[model samples]
Structure formats: structure tokens, C-alpha cells
Target chain A: MAASSTGLRYPSNKKTIYDRNINRTKTSELSRAAFAYLFVEMITYAQRRVTGIADLEKRLNTQGYPLGLRLLDLLLARTASSATTSPANLRPTRILPLLQFIHTTLWRHLFGRPADALERSAANAAEYMISDNDPLVNGYVSVPKEISQLNCAAFVAGVIEGVCEGAGFATDGVSAHWAEGAGGGEDMWPGKTIFLIRFREEVMEREEILGRAG
Target chain B: MRREWEGEKLPRVVFTLLIVSKAGGLIYNREFHAGLSKQDTNELLIIAGTFHGVHAISQKLCPVPPAQPPPSNIPTMPVRPSGIEVMESANFRLQCFQTVTGTKFLLFTEPQQPNIDGIMRRIYELYCDFAMKNPFYTVEMPIRCEKFDRGLDGFVKATR
Candidate 1:
């Protein structure tokens, strides 16, 4: 209840993050160059004393995880704040709706556009893929040939992982993979990235139980 | 009016921008215009270190303002010395803009160039966006970002 050292006094009533208005300000654009520079610095910092490319990616993913968690609430709050919508209606209960939320709403909020495609894994029922022809985060990045397997989009994958976990959908792991020229050479997006999201077996079991009840 | 006319006659060019960290390290050094001859990397580092020392000493040399009795109406913030801001030479002018966090931006420009303050502001804005916000940028380290370079180039060129 006491005032903090910075002289910021919050009322005795504790205000939660959700209590604040999310849409107080209209949509604003940030400089992409700044983001790229910061991302480059992040990569450089992560690369320091790292054993391999995988370790660097893990660091990037960890950095993005918190952002994803925060964004999930903010994005949903924005949708729920609109006059016509209720919070109940906005809550994504099913896997399909959750994926749709990420594919359309989350992508649009972060990248200014919807994902290129959302697909179910042909080989695995537990997996889903979100494709971005050219992820904005990777726009200014060029991975070295020696670390050819490394994709900076792992940060985005971490965000996806955060969103899934925050939404009560337990996931085993989320990974980013380069799928360049998958849609043929004619496609404009050459740096195509596919984020493979795999749900845990417990989540699948819960979904099956809920399916029968619904 | 006279200054504006003179400014128009002489080309407005930003020769270079050097960023010195709080710890007296040269974190970023970039040259925009090709006019100035490049200095050795060691020389640049020495320059940064010397400037940092001078800047700190200059702050100490500043005379303390006379204290006034607390007023009921207005809140007063503590005053800190703003060290050497500008250095002028025969051919070029050097302007220094220091941030609240002690990062210094030194811009070398044409002697007659106008609105150096505005240029400094934009640069700071770009730094905040690209460098500070970047999750990967650690404090007090060299910045080697293609985007930051490209953006700085575009901004400077567009202004010209």
C-alpha cells in the first residue's frame, strides 16, 4: 500500500494488467530498421560463447517467449473490447479456433498481415504448421552458410509457443523450419518459413474428452 | 534569413556519426559522406576515450546554480551539467548530443549546415527504435546492424 521509491503511488486496490484499456491509442507503426538493428544485436549477443546454432536459437526463443505470453492477453483483450463482442465469444476453446486466432489475429497484429497459410501436418495428426512467405523478423537477416540450418524465425516460433501455452493449449514444442521454394519459384515469397507446432499427448487426450461432451 | 540563404548555398552534409557509451567505449562509428578521410580504428577509439574524459571533467568544472527556497506552486527537478555541446572548425562542425542515460552522439557536419538539433533528435529516435528496443543488443557494445546503417543512410539522404 506504500508509495514506491520512484514516487509512483498506486491506489490500495491492486490493478491487474487486464484492467487497463488496450485500445486507448489507435494503431501506430514503428520503424522496421530499428527492429532489425535490435534483432541483429540480439543475435550477436546470443551468439557470444555459444556452442552451436541451436543454442543461439534457444536463446532467441527464450527472449521471445515472454513477449508472446504478453501479446496473447493483449490481442484477446483488444478483440473483447470491441462493442459487439463479448469475452466469452472471443475465447478460443477448440484447437481450430486457437490456430485461427494465431493465423489471423496474432499475425495481423505483429506483421500487418495474415499468415500465408495454416495447414495440418499430413504425416502427424498432433502437428500444425503456420507458414509465412517472408517473415518480417527475417527480412533483414542473412544466415551464414556455415550455420545454414539456423533460422532467425525461431524467435517467432517462441512467440507461437508462448501463445499456445498461455491459451491453456499445452504444446510439446514449436520449431521454425525454412521451406524456401516449396510453392515453386514463381512465388514472390522466397524466404518462406514454416512454424511447426506440436501439441502434447495430454492436450490431445483432453481435447478428445471435451469433444465427446460437446 | 541570411543564415538560411548561406545554408542553401553551402551543401548540408553529415560527414559522420560516432556513438560513445556511458563507460567511455566507442560503440558505434559510421561515416556517411565520403569527403572526410578515414581515421585508423585505434585513433577513433582514442578520440572517444579522450572525449569521454573531457566531458566528465567539463561536468565537474560547471558552476553550481544558486539554490532557491522551495516554492509551493511549482515542482523543481535537480539540475545536472550539460558538458561541451558543439565544436567548430574551419571546414566542418561537430555537434554532441548527450542522452539522459549518458550515451553521446557526435555528429560531424558541413560548417554552414543548419538544424543540427533536429538531425540529432531524429538520430536519437532511430537509436531508440533500432538499438535500444532490439532484444539482441547488449549494453555498451559495438553495433553492426545492416538495418540501422541502411535506415541512417536513407534518413540522411532524404534530408539532403
Candidate 2:
């Protein structure tokens, strides 16, 4: 074949990805500086063909969605297999438990800490909010005055949507935005990103039925 | 090492393996046992899409509503519908395993085959390594990873 003639085969000493252990890097940590560098590169790449800030965020979000789906399965598998945890790998079926899973397990896995806050929106029955005091994705990104309304956390919001959808909790939409300041709110945490999750009507209906049944 | 390599080279399972992408496209299909009628690529894609839609509908199917607010302790855990997991007929057995990300693995085996779940899990592990982690592989696209095909073939043979 053309591949062999061109000597495209990888040498054996350099183990192919398929030969590597899935958990080889589980406990290892990556340098934040390296991550920030990559984050900046991704943002610049995402910014290339955007009509507006909203469009750029949407592009970043789509990039993160696949990551969320992959991580949902990967993390669940790791939790089930890891000796440090209980063997039972239970997917949260109800809204409360799902929120708790994201708030604690998912947040910790991704950011090395639990999310700052998880709250239900008072005005909407089907909406919930998860807040991050300082998002690493936003750490390297600084918006210009014209695009100040855009939040790079939209990528993380897409990941959340992917996880929720993968876990069978259909979301109508998930988005990230800056929290409105009560003047002091801005001073306290300038980089705070609030992820808004709006669940679909079907999910809400199922939740109601399950709540009644329980 | 030789045995592991042999696993990939051999085709010995009396089962068929199918992988449906998250977007309801058939990504991979292999029939180790070929007595069943052959399906063209278009037909397979249609089947995958139909299955995906059916699974979504099943997930959305309403649970049984309690007549009134019950007194208490109707087994605290909530009831959730997990879409079709298995189907059996006179000639063949069908088992489906849906990943958290909406990918479906459809395994067709002998009617009386055992340990389908374990085999499914092994295949899922192979997929995670050979397909999911492959940089050349695109999300929700047809998987053309050569190692994936060989790995799945090997794993299935070893299991058999």
C-alpha cells in the first residue's frame, strides 16, 4: 500500500495511543501556565471568523460540547473503576442529584474545586444556575470594550449541556454570561461566570412524575 | 503479546457488532457471524437513525403518575426509563448499550448467548481507546481508525 511504501508506520518504541493506558495520567497534573497558553491560542483561533462576540462564543461552545460528552463517559468509567471510590457507578436520574453531581464531582474533576454556587432561578421553574468565581478559561481571555458582553465560559456551558444530554436530562439551552452587579458584585469577583441551564419541558414533566411517584 | 496480537487477526465470534454515532449515523458495522441477511450502507444508516429516534422517545415516555400525594416511603429512589436494552427472537438475540453521550452499540448474538453485558463493556472499552482517543477520528463521524477495527476484532475474538 502507499502508506507502507512511504514508511508511514510508527516505530514500536514510540507506543501508539492505542497501547497507552487510559489512566496513566489520571493523578498527574498539568501546569496552569501551559494550559493558559493553549487557552489563549484556542480563543484566538475561535475569534478568526466570527461575525460577532455571540458567534465566537457559539463556536467555542460547539468545540466544548464533544468534550463534555466524552468526559461524561470517561469520568463515569474512571469513578467506577478507581479503587479510591465505591464501585457503584450510579447516573443521577433526578434533577437534584444531577445538579449535585455537576456541582461536586464534575466541577472538582474539571477545575480541581467544587463550583462556587449552584442555585435555582427564582423567576423560572425550569431554570438553574451554576457559578464559578474564577473560570480558568476566562483567566487568559480579556475582552475588548466592544465585545465586553461576551463570556468565554460559553464553552464550559456547552460542556455542561453535553453532560446533561448524555445523562439523559435534555436541556432546552445552556449559556454563560456575566452576573449582573449590585455594584459590589463586580468588585468582589470580576471574572465570575454564571451558567444558566434551562431544562426542556419533557424533562420537567418526567421530573414531576418521578417526584410524585417517589 | 503474541496471544493479544492473535486476537486482532482472528475473526471467531458468533456475533455482529454495530456502532451508531451520536448523530444517528452508522459508524461501524461488522458481522462475525454472517448467516443473517446483508444490509447495504444506506439501510444500515436508516436503521441507526430509526433506533436513535425510538430510543429518544422511550427516554421521554412518562413514568406512572401517583394518584395522590402518597403518605411516604414508596421506595425513595425515582423511576427512570432507560430505553430498549435487549430484544430476543427465535433466530437471533439483540442487545443495545447506550453510552452517556448517545452513541449506541448494537450486538447481535446467538439467541442463547450469555454474558452479553460483559462483552458490551469490553467492546466499549476498546472503543474508548482505539476510536475515541484517536486524534484522526472526528466526533459523530464514521470511524476509520484502522487500530479500532483490529482492536474490536481482537477483543471480540478473545471474548468468544
Candidate 3:
């Protein structure tokens, strides 16, 4: 009787977040300029208290870290609960898969398009690249004479870096650079940015071990 | 008459928005669309400057007494930093909408513009949508963004 009571009182298994499903149609769409301007203001605001670019970048990273944490859950919920026939798989655990997810899924969600390219660094196993033909953050922003070296998207890079690090993937740091197009510069793509990702040595070793185990 | 106002084939034009701080400082500016007239643009800037002054005066004139203790009672909380300014002319109308936080939205429209309040609402909607939702966007500053411009242009053009 006690055993039956215990079984009935507390089920051994509980529903994980993965067990839930999301309604995909409710996702909100936003205007791009509003985001751009807002981001520009954010960077400018951060510019006030900080001593240098590194501090500003750190602030940006902090700003994005929470977002990354939120996105992880948001994407999972969206994928798991979708009524659509081709339900997307939930959160990716491994490094390659997570990178792929960011490149394709996250990029599409943010920019309405996939990243231009993603590749592992040949020289450094721990390094990766995510390229955007036009960076939304840089659009219409002509940095004045002073502080010209600053890329407002560095904050975004910090966020991406923070997210990767938070997800148990070891990251060294993330840096953003301008990627000039081959053809005459397109009118729409003034803010093209490429984010370079580097992981810690321990992470590379773990990746190798995981590769062998797989 | 209303047909031209609602015409779809107008040239691609964008209006940059700016919200100056109550202290006559440039607080917020966003170019919702591109290719607007220079005269209207200059007028909008002047309007932003003028309104900033007017908003300060209004806030000063309507001062409330201290509520809480000491520094806490320093007329904070419900502090309205500024107000709005709309510049409507024969060719176009520039709407400068401001919030209590001193943040402003400067929207440009055609001279025969109708439903301006709706247009302002849409601009505010865009501000909340893009600026607020974006983790990168800060509280206030000059807006220089291609996406915002493109989106604004698309929205206005569609409405037109």
C-alpha cells in the first residue's frame, strides 16, 4: 500500500522543457531601423562610463549575455511546440551543431537571412567565423572623427561570445570586422560585419576527445 | 486630391527622426525614410530645437511640490522631461514626438498627409518594436540605422 501510495503521490519522471511545444505563429516581427537606431543609442550610452573600447565591449557582452540565455530557451520552446509538420530540433549541445544553429537559425531569425559563411580556422582548431554581408548595427552609422575605431557591433560580438561561453562551449573571445564586398559597394549594405570566434585551449582538447568518442 | 496623398508610385523618400534632450541637446534622431527635401529637413531641426526649449519651460511652469523626504522628494518619479513638436508645411509634415524620458521620434510625411496621429503611432510602434526589443539599443541617442530607415520607408510607402 505504501509503495502504491508513493508511486501515486510522486511520479518518478517529470516533464522536461523539451517535452513542451510552442505556437510558432505568434512570433513578433520588428522594424529594422528602430533596432539599428536603438542599438546605436545603446553603444553611445555605453560610451559614456567606460574608459576604453574593451570596457565598452564588455558592457555590450553583458547586455547580450542575458539575451543569449533567453534565446536558448525561446528557440527551444519554438522548436518543440511547433504545430508545423517539420518541427525544428531543440537546443544543440555540441560545438559544431551549436555553431551551425547560430549560423543558420539564429542568423535567419535576426537578419532575415543566413550568414554569408561559416568556417573553422585551419590554423587553430578552436577558432570559427560567422560572416554577414551587411551588419545591421553599422547601417547609417558614420562614426565621427573621434572614436572611429569603435564598431558598435562589438557589443553584439560580446553577446555572441557570452552566449557561446554560457552554453558550456569554451570561448577565448569574439571580434568583429568590416567585410567589404567584391562588387561596387551596394547601397543597402553599409554595415557589413564579420565576427571571428576563438575558443579556449581546453575546449579544443575536449572537442578532440568528443570527436574520438563519437 | 486624396488619390495623390494615397499614391503608391511616389519617389523613395525617408525622413530622419531626432529627439533633442530638454537641455537643447540632441537626444534622439531616426531617419525613417531617405531622400527627403533639404528645406523640410532644416525646418525639422529648427523645430526640434524650439520644442526642446518649450518643453523645458512647460515642465518648469508645472512644478509639483516635494512628496518624499529630503533628496527623495526631488520631483523625480513622474518627471516629464519633454514634449512633442509637429512641423506641417505645404510639401511635408515633420512630427517630433517625445516621451517623459526625454526620448523623441521625428517622423516626416507628405504635405497632404492625413491621419498624422496614426502615423505618429506607427512611428512609436516602430520605436518600441525595434529600439526597445533590441538588446543592443540604449535608452536614447541619435538614430542612424539602415534597417530602421528601410523598414520605415517600406511602411510609409505601403501606406501611401
Instruction: Return the top candidate by lDDT.
Output: 1
Please report the candidate that would top TM-score against the real structure.
1
Cα-based lDDT at residue A191, candidate 3: 62
Estimate candidate 2's alpha-carbon lDDT, on a 0 to 1 scale: 0.78
Residues B1-160, candidate 1: write the lDDT tens digits.
Answer: 8867666567779999999999999999999887777898999999899998998888878766657656757777767899989889988898989999999999999887778999999999878766665444567888765556767998988888
Model 2: TM-score for chain B: 0.79
Candidate 1, A1-214: lDDT as tens digits:
2556222234346655446567854546787876877787778877889898888888888888889899898888778777578645476778988999999989988888999999999999899999998899987664545677888999999999999999999898798999965657325555689999999998888889989999
lDDT of 2 by residue, A1-214 (tens): 5445442245446566556566654666787656665666677678787898789888888878998888888777766666556524677789988888788888887888999999999999999999998887775454544667988789899899889999999998799999876367766787788999999999999999999999
Candidate 3 per-residue lDDT, tens place, A37-89, comes to 57766776776779986787777767777776667667656666664534247
Query: Model 1: how far is A173 from its true place, Å?
Result: 3.8
What's the DockQ of model 1? 0.10
Docking class of 1: incorrect
- Segments of candidate 2 deviating more than 4 angstroms: A1-26, A83-88, B1-160
Worst 10 residues of 1 chain A by lDDT: A3-12
Off by over 4 Å in 3: A1-21, A24-27, A83-90, A180-190, B1-160
The TM-score that candidate 3 achieves is: 0.51
lDDT (CA) for every model shown?
Answer: 0.83, 0.78, 0.65
lDDT of 1 at B67: 79
